[model samples]
Target: MVGQPSAYIIKKLIHDVETVVGKVLEDRSTEAAFWHPDRRARR
Candidate 1:
């Protein structure tokens, strides 16, 4: 029973980390696109 709770906690932590990393990558990509010369020239 104890192992089940620990396993659940670990899974949740892993999921949270993955979510954060995905968000960071998405934000970086958006920033890169905005600063890209072709995109900037259109503005």
Candidate 2:
């Protein structure tokens, strides 16, 4: 917070945050697909 963050540090932080966000989004999409009405209607 006090000093400027290096490029490497910033990239790492961004990568970590994106990875977590991607995982959450992927999970939600998978859950939605699993529960989609069309899927149930097809059965």
Candidate 3:
């Protein structure tokens, strides 16, 4: 790990966080946890 540059590690972390946030945003079911109406059931 020490062999990796700081910029590369930061970029990887940002990419991973974006991937997860994008996925979670795309899925409507997750809304129920914050609000009501599990809209994912419709699809």
Candidate 4:
């Protein structure tokens, strides 16, 4: 948005984003695994 971000800030931002995305996906998959019998078959 402004000037170039610092390396440490960039790394922290990326790490935070990945952690959020990974947790969301993990939770969704766990729900699907528990509720969807054909999930693996469809995959």
- Residue 5 in candidate 3 has what lDDT? 90
Model 4 over residues 1-43: C-alpha lDDT tens digits? 3465687788889999989876776779876566665874587
Q: How much is 39 displaced in model 1, in angstroms?
A: 18
Q: TM-score for candidate 3, please give it.
A: 0.54
Error of 4 at 29 (Å): 0.8
Name the top TM-score candidate: 1
Any residue pairs clashing in model 2, and if so which?
none
When 1 and 3 are scored with TM-score, the better candidate is 1
Q: Per-residue CA lDDT of candidate 3, range 1-43, in tens? A: 5787997889999999989876786685566445534554554
lDDT for position 26 in model 2:
66
Query: Which window of 10 residues has the lowest lDDT sum in candidate 1?
Result: 32-41
Stretches of candidate 4 above 4 Å error?
1-5, 30-43
Global lDDT scores for all candidate models: 0.76, 0.73, 0.71, 0.74
Ordered list by lDDT, greatest first: 1, 4, 2, 3
Better of 2 and 3 by lDDT: 2
Candidate 1 clash pair list: none
Summarize candidate 2's per-residue lDDT along 1-43 as a digit string, tens digits: 3375687799889999989876776678766456575764666
Give the residue spans of candidate 2 off by over 4 A. Answer: 1-5, 30-43
Per-candidate TM-score against the hidden true structure: 0.60, 0.53, 0.54, 0.55
Counting only residues 3 or more apart in sequence or on different chains, how many pairs clash (N, Cα, C under 3 Å) in candidate 4? Answer: 0
